[model samples]
Target: DNEIKKIKAEYVRSFLFENKLMPSTWIVIRIDGCHFHRFSEVHEFEKPNDRQALNLMNSCAVAVLEEFKDIVFSYGVSDEYSFVLSKDSKFYQRQASQIVSVIVSFFSSAYVMKWKDFFPFKELKYPPSFDGRAVCYPSTEILQDYLAWRQVDCHINNQYNTCFWMLVKSGKSKSEAQSYLKGTQTREKNELLIRQFNIDYNTLPIMFLRGSSIFRIKGEDSVMPENGTFEEVKQEIILSHSNIIEDSFWKEHPSILC
Candidate 1:
């Protein structure tokens, strides 16, 4: 038994570096689809934004939250998703590599598992994979900033893709569309959408611009004395397609972090 234990410990030693997350800090795991541009084309994703793909992504995110209760909030847009764990969490011993790896693996599996629900008639052309990384933030404000960064990126990329595709749909080749959008600022992009394409950029879906976030809320069935009583807590995960940069969101869901 002693020899067996020693050999088993050696087998597990290689994984020591993979799952370690910073102690007493918030853990954020972000996963991105690998080479999804070609994947989107092959799957016939709608231009501007694909609602089906977005739904699939959101579903996967929800699945992650369900599997990892410590993950209090999640945000996703386009081909990427970010999961935020509580600062006091001890999941997977708070290993960065373990947390990131499992989230990415589970997310990818969920995506593939639920693809049929989103695209029943459309078969998966090939296996889809995702890459992930874990980042630590000492403050909640910084975590909020990370979310804001992703939302800003979503707006920028969606705007650019919308313009590029609209131009292509109007008979311009891919190269021509790229050239036309080159060096164009945000104002220029908006003008192009309105003047040429007759699109109301402001009227686009908020989900396309700001992405989606899942906030988990816990409600107890009965009240208990804080002095010594115990209460049952039921968790509810709420999905929101709203701007998370403002203080209103944070204020509304104060218990998420604690």
Candidate 2:
């Protein structure tokens, strides 16, 4: 019994030490497409294609690296671009803001240039100015705000769904209930929903249901389950195959659903 106690204590201590020593300083950089105006006339070059979009995204990455060569450690671009640093560098954050600022400026200027090149004199209407003012170098908060704004502004036509569950006693259409639940209008709102409600673009309907349970349990009973974390619940929802959770599977297939 004494030897068993010593082994268990040693195992616990080692686990704690390993968890404590894990690095939390790494920086994750995500770069995705910004906004694009509809072409007045569908030129072969003007129409957005995966190949063209990828090329443009690559160009943006190159532009960022060229402007801030000293700060970037390593970067990659696929569907979206990302950079990972061994550790967070304040310099890189500063440079990221600068790069984003330049990209925004270039986007604005390029819009005008492309309009002139394509239309010449056909009374081209420029898209509305991104409500936010342009900056030479932006702060992280500003960059995040701008990115969020751009996302909503760019994808205005896309539909988002919110889910709701009421007790069997309540009589309301799920759609009507979900409408009252509210869709997020901003990136901050979405992030908060993901963190608090455990729902996001990638979350399945079943996952949403599990999240709903956890959310309700916490809200009403102040109780959490011992067997699962929020993420585990989310994963379980994804793995399950119930017809009632069809919406969840559809959420993961945006392109097909869209």
Candidate 3:
């Protein structure tokens, strides 16, 4: 029996690949909604942007931060989110598959579980899912660049969608709206919103424009003692919608990479 067990174990183990991530490198796990376009249509998500949907995504991100202490920050837009784990993290022994799968699965389940809280009037039509991938960034600069790229993408897509939806809502067909927006620049889109829709793109909610950023910050936690109450500074997870592409954000929150 010992001989047979040894042979089976070797054969099984040979088929498995650990795919460990590199040490001393930041691990970014990005999760994207699978078939979210159709999911949005089926669920009748609001056009351009949906506050409830965005709120739900942020909530799931907050949950991820709370569960994984090693994750220093997260940035999310639309139906996707990126979680950044500390470079020196030993979570799951730095196995790529394990880390990605666990985070994606948890986010999907959280989205399902918390659906009612954000959309009490709407019924979930089907099980929503997400796909995840893990990538390693060897330096803080590269990681910041990656995040900046996502934020820029969010801005571009949101601007286009805002214009497209506005056109559609004003009696233009979807095809016509697409044609009108095609090849238009950022400035043109802003002009369109103001000229045709009387909407100032800058006046939109910060969350919609800049995307959501989740990170840990030092905050006060009130503690009750027999003598009196005192405030203790502790790390608390928070969500914000601010410009991360600039040096100011990093300068202010230096502990994120440290």
User: What's each prediction's clash count?
Assistant: 8, 2, 0
- lDDT by residue (1-258, candidate 2, tens digit) is 999999999988886421111132433344443333333222223221223433433444444444443322222222233333223344424344443445445544444445444445455444422211212212333333433343343233222323233211146576665564466455644564466556673453332222111000112223357865532221110122122123453344332211
Local accuracy of candidate 3 as per-residue lDDT tens digits, 147-189? 9999999999999999999999999999999999999999999
Instruction: Quote the lDDT for 160 in model 1.
Output: 96
**RMSD vs true structure, all candidates:** 2.9, 22.8, 3.2
* TM-score of every candidate: 0.90, 0.26, 0.94
Tens digits of lDDT, candidate 1, 1-67: 9999999999999665654667888888899999999999999999869999999999899999999
Model 3 weakest lDDT span, ten residues long: 225-234
Models sorted by lDDT, best on top: 3, 1, 2
Q: Each candidate's lDDT (Cα)?
A: 0.89, 0.35, 0.94
**Candidate 2 to truth, TM:** 0.26
Q: What's the distance in Å from true for residue 136, model 3?
A: 0.6
Q: Which of 1 and 2 is the better model by TM-score?
A: 1
